[model samples]
Target: MNITKNTTGIESVILTSPDPQAAAAFNEAAFGLGARLQVRAGDAPTSGFRGFTLSLVVPGPSTVDSFFESALAAGATTVKPAKKSFWGYGGVLQAPDGTLWKIATSSKKDSGAATRTVDDFVVLLGVEDVKATKQFYIERGLTVAKSFGSKYVEFAAPAESVKLALYGRRAAAKDAGVAPEGTGSHRVVFGGGLGTFTDPDGFEWETLA
Candidate 1:
């Protein structure tokens, strides 16, 4: 397969949920984003975190608070309440279908800063072998921004594109304060310029033709 460098990162993600419509609606409202592709897996058992969490980075505390509140109103359960941290304000939310989300802002309020879209969006995938998966993407032309031994890794994608991260499966679940539930259909469809492929962890990535 010819893996072109995907400058757009992830254009969309197809999630498998017992209630596909509810999952779609929750995501659209919570992320202020939309998916380009949709697929349904009839009545599959949803499990914890599913080895990934979608991240949204905004500008300041207000945006974090607002987005967090909006997520709750949209039927997402609060995994972590928004709080101020050294990095900025952040929080976590779990959609009805067991998809975890982390919303954060690393920048302080700057009155002179022009309003823009969310600062960054990322798809954090948990894998059993970070080194191998990291190498897989590296061979496919993904630049690495930061890496820590074999435990964690981050890829360098465009600012406007969805970034990718890798973490140990158990560690990722712990980070989300959930138990590691091993092996099930993650039901994720990736949309961009890349082709369809399944990672070592059974997470699926599909692309736009």
Candidate 2:
């Protein structure tokens, strides 16, 4: 049997925050992510860049603006303001709890009325070596959907599951407009069918069952 046949890329993501209640409230108010995003009480000491950023891919520039504006209104500080680029429109923001969020879209203009709807949620983990981490996830049954040499890798995930990707630490931080230096816990964990195996960068994962 092909052991990788039954692999589920990423079933769930749990954020370990120092203030669970506040984190929960802020997330709900900001994005209404529902059960798609999870949070729990954690005091694991961490500082500076947490080595990851969550991305929200929306329908158009309008939708991107909707999320970007709301996140700012809900206590998120601007890392990069929403703006149109050659690829599309997007921006980065840091939540009150220090989570970096990237809201973006590939369309330069709105096709319809603007609404706060999200098209995709991506978890971008920053590692020291993209090639090594990509190989590691591949060995753990994650099928690579898109790859850009050693600079980045995007994994295929089940529908409704959060998408996973890997990027270099400095590049990921630069994309989020932050310093690359960091230490201590990543303060996050993933639950999936791949079982419990921490990535090379020290991000933890637990068995879904």
Candidate 3:
């Protein structure tokens, strides 16, 4: 899965779970996502479903409705109703790729946010031609932030940001600044006021604020 973000921050994650509804319920009860969007994923050999979407509780009411409408017009569905409740506004949507999503609103403002909430991160794969990758993101409506040589690049996405790093099987192994005894996929995690994780391929991701 390639997660790309630019400024907005990652509102949610869409994955293939054995039980989408149950997974949504578990997440909602655990993290307070208010609702779930329904998208059917074939068990197997069913040629797979068309698309998928999963929503996460966000901080405001801003353009959520409009966002949903646009998403829907671009091929989305309302598997569940959106309503106001103790949590906030809750809704569910089906993404164009048969992904299920649950979206909710949070009213509490962070007392310490000098800017916005310093939370969440998305990991994106990078190509050896990082300049081209960065340009690609810019053309795709994402904001390019940092490019660290042909070895890595980073982009900003709505609600979340993305980190892209070039991974040449042999070159990266040598660039690790370590003895290349054993290597496959590696993981790096950073935690503090914000938390982040790097995939085996050196892409960094975080969930915070």
Global lDDT of each model? 0.73, 0.87, 0.40
Task: Write the candidate numbers in order of decreasing lDDT.
Answer: 2, 1, 3
For all predicted structures, in order, the TM-scores are 0.84, 0.94, 0.32
Model 1: number of clashes?
A: 0
Please give the TM-score that candidate 3 achieves against the real structure.
0.32
Deviation from native of the Cα of residue 101 in model 2, angstroms: 0.1
In model 1, state the lDDT of residue 181.
Answer: 81
Among all windows of ten consecutive residues in candidate 1, which has the lowest summed lDDT? Answer: 1-10
TM-score of 2: 0.94
Indicate the residue-level lDDT of 30 in model 3: 32
Candidates 2 and 3 compared by lDDT, better number: 2
**lDDT tens digits by residue: candidate 1, 1-209:** 12233354666666776777777777777666644335456565545557888888888777777788778899889888878777777888887777788888886564444333577778888898999998987766676777888998887776456788899988888767678885556757666655677777877777676
Per residue, candidate 3 scores C-alpha lDDT tens digits across 94-124 of 5443444455565433333222221322333
User: Lowest-scoring 10 consecutive residues by lDDT in candidate 2?
Assistant: 1-10
Superposed model 1: Cα runs more than 4 Å off: 1-8, 36-42, 108-116
Model 2 regions lying over 4 Å from their true place: 1-7
Scored by TM-score, the top model is 2
> Candidate order by TM-score, highest to lowest?
2, 1, 3
Alpha-carbon runs more than 4 Å astray in model 3:
1-12, 29-118, 126-131, 158-209
